[model samples]
Target: MLSLKKIAIPMLTLLLVVSAIGLTNAAPSTQAIETLNIGFMQAPSSTGDFGVRLAIDQINREGGIVGPDGALYRLQVVYPNRPPFAPDGVPDAVTSLVAQKAIAIIGPVDNRLAFPNLEVLAQAEVPVLTLATTDALTELDPSDNIMRIRAADRFYNEGLATVLIDERAITSFALIQTDVDSTEALLGFEGILVNRSLTPTVKIQEIDNSNLQADAERILQGAPAAVVMWGPPEDAETLLLRLRENGFTGLFVYRDAQEAVRSGAIPISLARGMMGATSWSYTTPTELGRAFLVDYVTSFNSIPTGVEAAAYDAVWILRRQIEQTGGDITKLREGLLQTPTIYAVQGRLEPSTYGGGDFSRAVTVYTMGDLGGPQLVARFANNVRLGDDDLVATDVRVVGLAGTLTYTPSPSPTPTLTPIPSATPSEVTLTVPQESVNLRAGPGTEYEIVGQLQLGDTATVIGSNADFTWLVINHEGQTVWVAADIVDVFDPGNLLSQLPIVQPGTNNPGIEPGQLSEGIDLTIEGVVLSPPQISPGQPFTVQVTVRNLGVNAAGSFSVSAILQPGNLTITAGSTGLGAGQSAIVTLNGTVDGTGSYTSSITVDATNAVLESNENNNVFPLTYVSDRPILSRIDFVQIPVGTAFDFAGGTADMIWTGTQIEGQNNARFGIVYAGAFEAVDYNAIDPSVVINFILPGSNIGTGSLIGFITAEGRRGVMRVDSLVGTALTVSYRVYSN
Candidate 1:
């Protein structure tokens, strides 16, 4: 529990009376009286708080949250020790933190744990400092106060993309998600690629691995560059071992970095160089990183991982906010809006691309080697390219991916099934001895002629249409029929020649999976579900979804909304049924949107999934546009030293401009530092726009300024030296 002691100043007359009565010594005044309480919510067993606590104390120790001569303050740290957070159980600690009157709380270490109590935090206006796992909890923008300190899931997924291009030589991909929502959000990856016209050759599937052999058979049929897997490490280990033992040696990509490390999914030697995306930049701006290392060692008595460091950043950021705003929420919001670029051990916290809000944070790419080891950062880029090859090795040199993994099977799956039918019959024509012949249904005459066979209709003679029956001379076409006993006949064409057809269902164009191909407008959602086991009866359930919103079902009726699971297979992506009808389809994929992820259906369809009625199909897409919303500089890409003029005004910001959201998938980039300037630092006014909130002076339609955005409505965007936040969303759209 925190120590928040409210000192009551006795009446001045009483004090004078006490002084006169010589009771002054008994009432020696108390110091650190206006105890400022900050909440710290975290898993009971988590060590992440060690660093966070230290950071909070350190910042406070220097000068509390007060100015040089302003009223100084003290903070009492409270741990709502609830449950085995790193272990299990709904974190009762979150409730405890709220009870403690903590202005800002930090550390739940994992997404799953943080999500359950979002409502509680939202009601309290207490922001969450993300400590661990990109469980999609941080992104669901419930309130401006619920900010995250951790790097998000997009980085890991994006880093995986870079890994495929560099180490795996992946030109094409077939992304296979499991029944986990955190991983399914990858559908936005294509949206990220498409805004720039990059197309990934891919096949995305949702699977029912009831029969691994059968599932494997289907997946193996379509060879891909590499398979992107987003399941638990344990499940991945099982799947990878099975696929590898089954002889799938192609590149196998792991979603979360730790998953790969634990499962040993890839070559141990190549482990370090593995690309991972996360808001926590494990290796960037090495100075803050090195200092954090020393402090972490001293405080925790052990080394901290990027995830842990991220949690620490969350707490520090909160402490900073509290100090800057003097514990007033009005200042808290404004300060957050005006925040400057923050470079903690974790990646920088910039704005998101969606509507300029604190909901979105920047995602930085990292290469994880080993704990306590130097990790490197991959520079930002539109998409990973060839010249970037050297950049990969430089980031995390510990795991040197020396060679490329080209999928050329030593003994590829070559099905040598020579199905030669047991019998080979000859084609024949017949003539009748008599004027007319009867056509029997059966060759032996036991069967009757159900219908008449016309002459020149090329019906099989079959011993005559009817056994022992006589046929009249055919019509004036000059064709004659023979008597049943008079006709001579032989073999007939094989009765059947067509393959069995798979029943068709209504079609829906979901998030299509492939390599960066020409960007196709897609509707994608973020969801959380259970791990899909190849064997049934795993007590699996998927709950909570946040989707890209839109209208206009694109495909035909009776066709299914397909899901493709890659190395970790889901189901088929394409289903051809009748047209214009709806059906329900349960897919197994992952949900890894940047921050805001909740339990709701990603898409609305008869068969695909049923989203909550409250949701208006909000897909994660955003854009910056207006006649003068953006500024076009005199010269583009001008030298850094050149001065530029940017008109300033309030322009419309459509984080996702499309009427329907999420079709235009975007990867929001932010560059703003949390700040509030222009007036005296102590001025606390909501009406005054923070310096960072202003996008360039007057940019044309395409550019935007600082407005923290999520994949949905927030992230970081820089406007000149004054960095800001912006959002990149993948929204769906109907016919305009």
Candidate 2:
């Protein structure tokens, strides 16, 4: 907004004198033509001003402000050279310019400052080409003295209003902005949705610039599908950093990002996704402004100021006005009202015939590409082209109705991965070692052999030191040592050597089961050779045993132990020390899951597969077949604390047929309601729960059975499906 209020008095005199004299300075045949002083009130520190300067210089060199006689009117620029000013001083500066007789004004460079100068320029009836956004300045029709070639504030926000909704496929916009000018502009975007009668669920998170944390908390709570930061670079950048740090991963849009990108506050990678709109991508560029940009880059190897293109257009507007008007102020005014319609710096404005004010508001929405560079993404066509009164005025807000929303249950199954097996083992055994073995200083066979042993060599395997086996061997005529793996143990060594693992306990950085009351120091115990690899929030196993020191009934007692899959073994025995005595049971070896999984050892743990120990080697736990099993579950909410209402025992329950070789009917069930919204099957975990604890809540039981279906799924899970294997199941509960 330009204001020549201070210049009102003195500028009136100059205008009147000029009107009275009609002193059109004619070109002297002898040369040394007179000049025209164009008041360039732009901030010298501003990039837009430099652009305007370039255009001014180029025109002067090419015979500027071509007069009625065709003589070049040299432009003397007066960059507001005054120091910081109090209220009174600002007017003094403008009035001083009027006294100097500047016929027209270019800019004060910034939009906020543009208005003060507008008061004076508009007073002189001199049109000021503002290289900034904010249509309100022109909307005021302030003497028609303000003609903006550049877009105003709401320009980019409005463009993104559609772009984000479309390109990003977002139906929800979280409006997080500084509670200021941009905030209103962002909120102003609601009108766009309303005009289309489309209500978008918009949540507002007004970030307090001073408190980054509180702002971040408020935004996260807003649960916006996308955040539109409606503020300047300074505030937005700070908020963006906090948002990222807090892990609010989502899409973000910025209104003005030049400052943000160059600030180094927002990391470059994060800035790439940013989108914004601006009146001037750079300064003083005209229809051929892009060329000037390229030239500027070639010369300086950096991006020019944001206002550069606008400044370039400003000069072009001046030249075209002077040229078309035949140096007549009236003709120049008419051209300002017309041609340069599209205001393109590189190409002629798309339409070329659009009238000023409305058409000059043309803006090209841009996306921020790599390294904060700008790329034109789209240009909204004129509202006139709509050709219908159906369109409402821009900037209307406060619709009566809010947006709507719906919750669709996930159609495809929720993504789930086989939690890394509850067990990962570094424990290994070599069925056979090199016939002859060399013992080295380290556990590896490749280590330098410190001694040797032969085919008949005898060695006692203490235990595996690591992935390689450690052993003490007897060499002919000498005592030597070697890796048991290298020595070829006929049977695996006792695995207890790795037990009692050094572990974090009860305090911090330890297992949840181990978390005791706070303040106590976490005492690390011995490292267990094998810890089960298990899913977080899933039941894993740990084993502990107490020897019988007293007599008790033996019909069917239960004992519990976490399956030490790492040790690959379990142990039990009657030490038989005495009825009132005890001995170390040394729960020993077992082979099972590769990770730490907790399984209770029931004296009658009931579903124990009831097979003899020999069957451990006979059954592979998970068997491969021509088909695979795939089962999916849908959950309906159940209120907490209510007993599961499974169908009564009187009802007949049915087991869907299972094609998996050993899968029996009794292993699963689909009761009306059970514990949680959990659907389990052999495909994910093979432990067939052959026995169930009948619910006391109702005098019955319930279950979910997995039986065979179509082709099946890939066996990466267990067996390959496309390779002739994919079995699925549908289970429903029947009363037994």
Candidate 3:
């Protein structure tokens, strides 16, 4: 929740300024005062919002933008009441901003939040200044409204690859994708390498931190000259630590290594000599960038990151365009496109040939200094035009004295073809025996199916579960898991023990399950909701199992369950627990929300008990009411050939969710039922069968349809209106 002081202070100051203006103007004036609402998607205290607020204040102080109609428009920042990453939060925030008549929107900086809601923001028909660096956003935007303020990930990928291949002269490289967001980075880097007539020695995709050790071992086996990774800072740090611990001496490069070091996820000692790339750096040589850094630091009492710089630049750019266009909302996009370039804090803002909205092409490569800071090594202006399949980077140059550093390759033993009689085989393979086996995302049936292997299809095994119940295999270049029972082991050398134990998608670091810790370590083993689905305001019990895995005993500690949106808090406490002891703490609470509520359970709410790792104390449990959650899709007009994914909660053609398209997850074209009237939400049963076939051309307004999501949750859709190929509908999805 945003604090009143944070929002009210600026508004109050604006009010006083307006009042002063009115008092001072004794004579009648032709100019009328209006408010220009600017929507911000991040939290009020976030760096992006801070930059926006500062810009808004400055604009208001300068008497705001003057329209051609002779009206003074004051800038006012608006934020969604909900957190940006929450379910439906982005769309809901966009709706709120549209209602406020916002001329522009700035940031939902995270790629995960921004990518899915591109259509929602585009539908608003307002310029959205996005700080997210994912290159896919340029391709994903349905409208020209999404303007990227920062250089896309491909720039960083290109810059990092240049440093590794050109400077280090590393031919053999290993690429690691640590998360879903890293897919584009991994592919972009690989493409750059392939274009340079070099192939990656190893490619590890979607490697979770739980399987970091295994993936590190795989990288070591490849023995590439350098390893380039892209992922979250925490996962990158974990993998780097593991790789280093396993005696890996190869050059390590990650695009987010600076971020990892700043967040203290990776220590400076470990990050020393490692290379990274970023869109912008505080050590920028540009005059405008230097001034921005000074002003931002003086105002906020902190050095600004790339997000802050992008936000500040975005606001200023919008102001300039608005002033030029006379505050005409419809002309903003045209004005931006017609303008050749605008010099701002992030260097030259020129329209990208790849996408209309991508303005900057700046990328900076840096290496960690011995004094625990980033030392600029090189800078690049990536100009690989899109649609031509050109992966070559242009305007690349080395920067600063650090660029002179030379790389010395680690000595390696020559490979031998002769097999040792008693040694285990270096590789293991698996083949599906009788029927097709599902390749899942994790090591369990609950995990989503990513792909499938037919009978006799073979794949090299990379990892396995603790008991080898599920084997991780490279299926069609994707790392997926297959049940060991369904696959026949082709290891004649009996080297099953060589496979590294992996728990995919799990984040339990440093401590394994059922393993005791050296010091006080409290962890939540499991959470069970007595009635998983209940009516709104219905009381429920949350049973959380807390175990002290530490060898040392823990003193008095408390457990709490806080339900979000309603903030319903329930707590229970324990006197003391011995080492290796377990206790079940039950918390009773009633939530008021009709939709989904995430209860965050904390083992030590007040920090009364010290634990070895505090990261595992908080656990999230999502439970929904039995009553269906209602969502409205209004006035969405899509082309006839396109499809809408209901689970994505948008009218966009893209399927952003994990549900496999055309399979269990059917789009609008596959799941449309025949016309029916007066749809009853509660009457629709979860098991009610719906015809899964293409709808007739005559289906239009007043049509009631029932459908099931890929997750097997049933829902009913009611058509409100239809015009040509455009259709408007409302849906109610059941929790069960």
Candidate 4:
């Protein structure tokens, strides 16, 4: 508990008066009040300073914190010129703040700057509220005194994998990350996937000589299912645009460096379809958030980014700590840890073991789309801890708060307990899906077992635990509880939201395997064929989703994609799936013949699974066939680097204003580059080129210009030799 003592000034005044009347020998004393010194780096041009000033103003307006000795004190801001990572700024402005005895540090926002100073600040027992998104900052804090205002880095990794792999079924990808600390930490995540023997693949390619286009072309040539870029906002967006401009039709994923796109630094057309994750979005539906947006825009005349919002929240968090601790800096850390969740402009701010104040908060997955703005595509609530998949490494780093520090919950004296009425005061009907479900005396499985409920047994649920993972029920005239996952609540009503949050015991083992009665439960929810119609020899995708709909988890179930006629089957199965969890099996193969084909996707097709409904385990799919048409061709030559008009041309060259190699006008669907004779046009093969040779290389050609295009379309351009003002050129364009 915080040591907040409110002094009675009147009592002290009376004692002073008595002392003045010669009743005491002690001399009159003056109480000394200490100001809370918060150090932060002030940027020359930033709204960060404004945000801090606003918080300080609001705190002072509410009457500055009153110390235990009836002495009032206020926050004092300290701006240090040399923050960490500045030229020769190794000691940090934090070191100066420490010399001045600062109780807490507010910022020096960049992760590279803040990372090296976290341990130093924590060692001094000074708490920090940083705007950096690096997981390493909090991940390495020994004293758990460093709390991030923004979300950590690991969540971005989780968000990417969740969307690209789990949701989109994109199993293969390439990683191109900038050489930075945050991205460097994310480097070995491929090992996370490999260790688990996961099917999804990720190849991290080194930036070759810092040539983005060259490295990008190399990676895209493999045609990965997706591309994940982690770097500075501009670098990532630029890479995304280059990939798109090159006709790469795969997904792009990134971390929290999305503010650049939000600010429209990157053109909407180029950045469209690029996805990233962030903790807060302007579209958050809350009165506080709405008010914040208005106030921020009015103050700064611009939209607030996540950094500004987080900085604003940091000031408020420190203010609350000051008030709760009665201006005692020693108790500030405890005050922060024990304070109830604060509703801020961003969302509910809560302390987590991750050392971030809002670590477990949900993240909005945003994508720049054709709508000319960023749009929210999905939201993930739970914080994805450091090493969940192959894309994330197992971080031994953690903010160890448990067992060492004693957290005293804020004062809220409980009222006298009373017994409930037996006659179903308020009831919701729920059914236990399996036989022999343990009705524990308490909400968790670790509690004493009271009785057993049979399969299909209906119960009257009166209440639920905080997380709604367990429900209280009336059974045999005794109030008991069953795991919520095993029961189907027919009339949920507002029971979930209305239930008071209660801390569950450590033993809350969700339904265990031995506790379930094996009935029947397996389902093939859907069979989806991508491209619906496949041209001969082109690979089409088949996606099947299998759900474990039973009361218990289904184990080792096989799902097969069966193509009719030859009984060609592509089988994929999962090791296990918990109840309500679905496994999406994606199979890609070519349909060689030109004929309509039907596919039957079946879960447990071999009759190996026993479930509640066996009939619903099959999903039907149909795929159409189409023939590939060859493109038409026209042969003509235009002067290199010369402006040409193709507006009235009979052939569809669709002249783009762009020129290749400073010459050669472009066709709408093709790319061409000209080369001199000394260089081998043979060795110089570009992804966009097809074939090229001067009209006659054997005859002394003045300047041989070679051209190359995509595979489906072939184009040849020859330098017919320089003759007078018209540099004669011959070219033939062919399409399949």
Against the true structure, what is every candidate's RMSD?
A: 32.9, 32.8, 23.5, 33.4
Ranking of candidates on lDDT, top first = 3, 4, 2, 1
**Against the hidden true structure, what lDDT does model 3 obtain?**
0.62
- Encode model 1's per-residue lDDT on 1-736: one tens digit a residue: 1111111222211111111111122211121213456655642224465555555544432223341224334454555533223223334566666666666666565655556655654555555554544534545654555565553555445655555555545565555555444443456555544544556555444443344455455455656556565544544555555666667656665545543564354444444444445443435454445555655555445556656566556555555454456566566666655555444454334534332334224444545465523354554322332243422222210100101111111121111111111122222234332233354222333433323444323322211222234332222221123343444332222211110111111122222233111211222322222221111212322222222222323332121122211122233232422212122333444321111111223233343432223233322211111111121111111111111111221111321111111112322222222421111111112222233223234332333333321222222222222112111111111110
TM-score, one value per model = 0.42, 0.44, 0.50, 0.45
* Candidate 3 regions with alpha-carbon error over 4 angstroms: 1-30, 352-355, 384-736
lDDT at position 692, candidate 2: 34
Model 4 stretches astray by more than 4 angstroms: 1-35, 42-44, 62-73, 84-90, 99-101, 188-202, 205-209, 262-265, 352-362, 384-736
**Span of 10 residues, lowest total lDDT, candidate 3:** 397-406
Q: Tell me which residue pairs clash in candidate 3.
A: none
* Candidate 4, residue 511: lDDT: 35
Q: Which ten residues in a row have the lowest lDDT in candidate 1?
A: 397-406
lDDT of 4 by residue, 1-736 (tens): 0011111122112110111111122111232223466766533124365566545433332233444334444565555433333323535666776766667877767666667666665665476777777667666775667667776666656666677666677677777766556454365445444543544344554432266777677667878877777666666766777778888898777654357666555666766677877766665554445555655555455676666766767776666555445555669876676555445655554564333444335466778668555576665545432221312212222111001111111122211111111111123556554445888756766766769988657775555665788876656644467888766564312223332222222222333445433564776644445444455667776655555655677778787876643456777777888874455666676644444555667788888766766777766565544443222111122322222222222222211212232113332212233332122222223453332222222222234333433232333444443332223333333322
TM-score preference between candidates 2 and 4, better one: 4
Off by over 4 Å in 1: 1-34, 60-69, 81-93, 114-118, 131-142, 155-169, 190-220, 246-249, 259-274, 281-285, 351-377, 381-736
lDDT of 3 by residue, 614-721 (tens): 877877776555453433322222213223444433222221121212234433332333432223333454444443443444245666656665566556666555
User: Whole-model Cα lDDT per candidate?
Assistant: 0.37, 0.40, 0.62, 0.51
**Between the candidate structures 3 and 4, which one is better when assessed by TM-score?**
3
Encode model 2's per-residue lDDT on 1-736: one tens digit a residue. 0100100112112110121112234233333333455555533324565566555544443233445554535554444433112223335555545555555566555544554444554555455666646556566654666666665555555666667666556766566666444444655676665665655444454544665567677777776777777665667777777788888777777766655676565667777767676654543233234455654554335566556666666665565455435444455555566653232442223223543353344445566678676666555433211222312212111100001111111212211111111011223222222246665433444434656655443444323333433543323422223654333333211222432221111112212323232221111111122222223223323222222222321222232233433433343433232222112222334343322233333222332222222111110111111111122111111111111111221111211111222111223212222322233222323243222322222222133333221122111111101111112112222111
